[model samples]
Target: MKKLVLLLIVLVFACKNETKIIEKPIEAVKAKAKPTTKFILETLKSKGFKTFDYVDTKTKDTVIMQQYFIAFLKSGPIRNQNEEESTLLQEQHLAHLGKMYDLGYADISGPFGDDGDIRGITIYNVPTLKMADSLANSDPMVKSGRLQIEVHPWWAAKGFSLR
Candidate 1:
């Protein structure tokens, strides 16, 4: 009977120790896991993106700023296309913009509601001005002389969304 009790006690202790061992590794994994902001910054850095960090004075929160390119779509010298040709070029232009967004090159693109020289804007997420210019100039509207591209380097906080 004493041996049986001793065996039971040993089993209980063994189980308890096993549980502690398993739990420790889990805690270690939790500790090693990176926060979302850190992961984002690391990913941006890995991709060769130009980034800087700053602390907001009011909130004391770290903000990650990245260099982005903004392409201004302006009225080109030639706009004498017929209605059909113009419509086709407009459709192609929209498709190109959509492709850029899908490929993670452009973040947002939209046309202005006014009749002005600056017809619209596209914010490219690429790291270089040259790349942004190439993508913007590839638009069918630009190729057809219905629009022109003027690219400029812009900076904005990463992981932000438009309200």
Candidate 2:
């Protein structure tokens, strides 16, 4: 083991060059292209926040997330709902959120649940949290006592697009 370790160390030292040495494959690697920030521009404009970048005059801010937390209740009449009722409720839940666009909300998902009555809460990115909060407070889900909403800060660190 001692001899093996000594040999390994020698091999490593022999392979390393102390000075800059151009090798056969040196030209193979080209400079990598910088990441584009185009999507960020459009997202900011759409949300009504004006954006400016030092590198480009046209790039938008896509990292802004107008988000909200919506909670739903699973107990009550829905406590013992059938498959048909379950499906209908699912549709209604999504449609209800979609309707919130009239009140200015964006990027919504889930009335999802895992146990009991299966409540769903979703996060949305909007121009302002107030709009989302108001929508949630006036939401049929909230009014029905089967849902609740909380507004909070949200952001997209990089890249933007509907998945």
Identify the leading candidate in terms of TM-score.
1
Clashes of 2: 10
TM-score for each predicted model, relative to the true structure: 0.80, 0.43
Candidate 2 TM-score, true structure as reference: 0.43
Worst 10 residues of 1 by lDDT: 34-43
Task: Give the distance in Å from residue 58's predicted Cα in candidate 2 to where it truly belongs.
Answer: 22
Q: How does candidate 1 score on lDDT?
A: 0.94
User: Tens-digit lDDT track for model 1 on 1-163?
Assistant: 9999999999999999999999999999999985777788888888778888899999998999999999999999999999999989999999999999999999999999999999999999997888999999999999999999999999999878989
Candidate 2 off by > 4 Å? 1-91, 101-104, 116-118, 158-163
Candidate 1: misplaced stretches above 4 Å?
A: 1-39
Q: What RMSD value applies to candidate 2?
A: 14.0
